[model samples]
Target: MIGPTMTPEILARITAARAARDLSDLARQAVGTTAETISPAERIKRARRMRQMVNAYLDTVVVAEALAGADWSEITEALGRREPDTVEGEYADAVAEWSDAAEAEADAAADVEELDAWYARHREDHDPDLEKPVADLLNRH
Candidate 1:
C-alpha cells in the first residue's frame, strides 16, 4: 500500500539525518586526532571551530527535527548513545565553558550601557558647535 506523505515529518527526519551525519563526522575527526604535528591547543582550537560548525548546522537540524514531530528525548538519547561520552560530553563541556564566558561579557556590556545612559542624562551640554550650526543658518533671528 502507498504510504501517506507528511511534509514536516519528512523534513524533520531529513534534518535530523543531516545533523547526525555532521556530528558523526566531527566525532570521527576528534577521535582520530593523535600525537602528530598539531599540538593539543591547536587541536582544541580546531575542535572548537568544528563544534561551532556543528552547532550552526544543528540550528537548522533542530528546527527541522521539531517540524518533523520527533520526540526530543528520543533524539537526545540517540545522539548520546551514538556519540558516546568522550566525544559529545567533551564537546558539550567546552561549549558550555565558552558560553559562560560570553554571558559574563554580555552582562558587563549591559552594565556599561546602563552607566552610559545614566551619565548621558546627567552630563552637561558642552557643545558650542550645536549652536554654531543653528546660528549660521539663522543669522538675524
Candidate 2:
C-alpha cells in the first residue's frame, strides 16, 4: 500500500537520536555536580540542551515507527491522544497554525492548479455531480 517513505536523512536521525537518548549521563558529567549545586544559569543551559535530546528521541521514534510500516492513521491517533493539555484558545490557535502550514507546504510542493484540475477530472469520472476539491494535503489532528 502507498504510504509515507523514509527520507534518506532518516538513518542519520536514528543514529543521532540513539546518541541523544543516552546524554543524561553525559549531561551529569558536564554539569559536574548535582542540580542543587549548579547556578540557575548553568541549570538552564543544561535544560536547553537536554530538551533538544528529548525532542530528537521523540521525533526519531515516531518517524521510524511510521516508516517501518506501522499504520500512519493509528500513529496519528495515538499522537493526538498524547497531546498536552492546553487552554481552549491555545489549542484553537495551534490548530489554525497547523492547518495554515499544512496548506502552505502543499501549495509550495506542487502545481496547485494542475493538481486540483486533475482531481476534478478524476472525481467527475467516478461520480458525475459529486465532484469536489481534493482534501487537505496533510491530514491534521
How well is each residue in 46-126 modelled by candidate 1, as lDDT tens digits?
889787877766655544444444555555665654544443443444344433343343333334333334334434567
- Runs with alpha carbons beyond 4 Å of true place in candidate 1: 1-6, 68-141
In candidate 2, what are the lDDT values of residues 84-110, reduced to their tens digit?
333223234433343334333333234
lDDT of 2 at 27: 76
TM-score of 2: 0.40
> RMSD in angstroms, candidate 1?
21.9
lDDT of 1 at 5: 28
Best-fitting candidate, scored by TM-score: 2
Residue 31 of candidate 2: its Cα lDDT? 63
Worst 10 residues of 1 by lDDT: 132-141
